[model samples]
Target: MHVHNSTRQLSLNEELTMSKKLIALCACPMGLAHTFMAAQALEEAAVEAGYEVKIETQGADGIQNRLTAQDIAEATIIIHSVAVTPEDNERFESRDVYEITLQDAIKNAAGIIKEIEEMIASEQQ
Candidate 1:
């Protein structure tokens, strides 16, 4: 029974390690409504697609949920949905990024997630 439990735990750890990590940055000129909304949309879409996502919002209050270096390094893709350019945009300079307008993110986040998944799949092929 102990051996079986250890095997199960190892599988769980493998699953977590194998899951794709996604990071998003959202901002708008006004930096209020659109920024937060787009972040929420992207988070929902990513979760539905089985990705672990972290979102940073550049809004009226300034940056929130800021991304760490570790987060950036582990992420498979970065999504930028902004009306104005985001702060610390250089942090993602070396990463695969998908940039879109705030409107597009709020209205079509699921589509964007699907596109990223396809992009990753193609690269693997």
Candidate 2:
């Protein structure tokens, strides 16, 4: 019984330590459709996966919904869906970063999240 209790406690602790937030930086060469579309797709996918998500867009309109230091710190992972280099990328230098194309983010956002989730689970194991 003590062993079972300990195991249960450890599981709970692990779950608590797992982050529930995601931060995405989406950009494109023209700062147009791909940028905003990818951001929207990622946000929707993250939300459907029950994660608190913040998506920053670097487009022709410039950076919108810019992510802050606190957001980066709380995120489980930082995803960059950009054709061009994302701005302020130094902020994610020490983060668990995932890179994907803007089109991929827009078309397969759910798959991207699922893959990340699997990666996280594997790391925990």
Candidate 3:
């Protein structure tokens, strides 16, 4: 675990509390490897780029880490790297959403995150 030299250790919840949130959903037709691989890549990339990630992985079992209404409302960015359309996708109807393939997310998540950072920067200006 990465830690800072501070008087107190921060829990995961505490660390994420002040963060810029990024929400993602990753799925694939088979609901197997690609579904999980892409979600992990995207989450790692987002965290390294200073965003807190809340990811939903859809597979044969079901969705994990499902996003809540509050999570969606607070998200600074939303990405869907999916082969199959997500089950509850309409939650983002009024939000700016980005889509990518599972392969793209797994292979180029750093580049994807950098681009997203730039996009947010330009929009803020």
Candidate 1 per-residue C-alpha lDDT over 24-94 given as tens digits, one digit per residue, 9 for 90 to 100: 99999989899999999999998988889999999999999999988977776678888887788888766
- Any idea what lDDT model 1 has? 0.80
lDDT of 2 by residue, 27-95 (tens): 888998889899999999999999999999999999999999889767776788888887888887656
Return the number of clashes found in candidate 3.
Answer: 0
Q: What's the candidate order when arranged by decreasing TM-score?
A: 2, 1, 3
TM-score of 1: 0.83
lDDT of 3 at 12: 57
Q: Write the per-residue lDDT of candidate 3 for residues 57-85, one digit (tens) a residue.
A: 99988988998878876777788899988
Per-residue lDDT value at 106 in model 2: 89
- Indicate the TM-score of model 2: 0.85
Query: Could you report the Cα RMSD, in angstroms, for every candidate shown?
Result: 10.5, 8.6, 10.0
In candidate 2, position 111 carries an lDDT of: 94
Clashing pairs in 3: none
Cα RMSD for candidate 2? 8.6
Superposed model 2: Cα runs more than 4 Å off: 1-19
Rank by lDDT, descending? 2, 3, 1
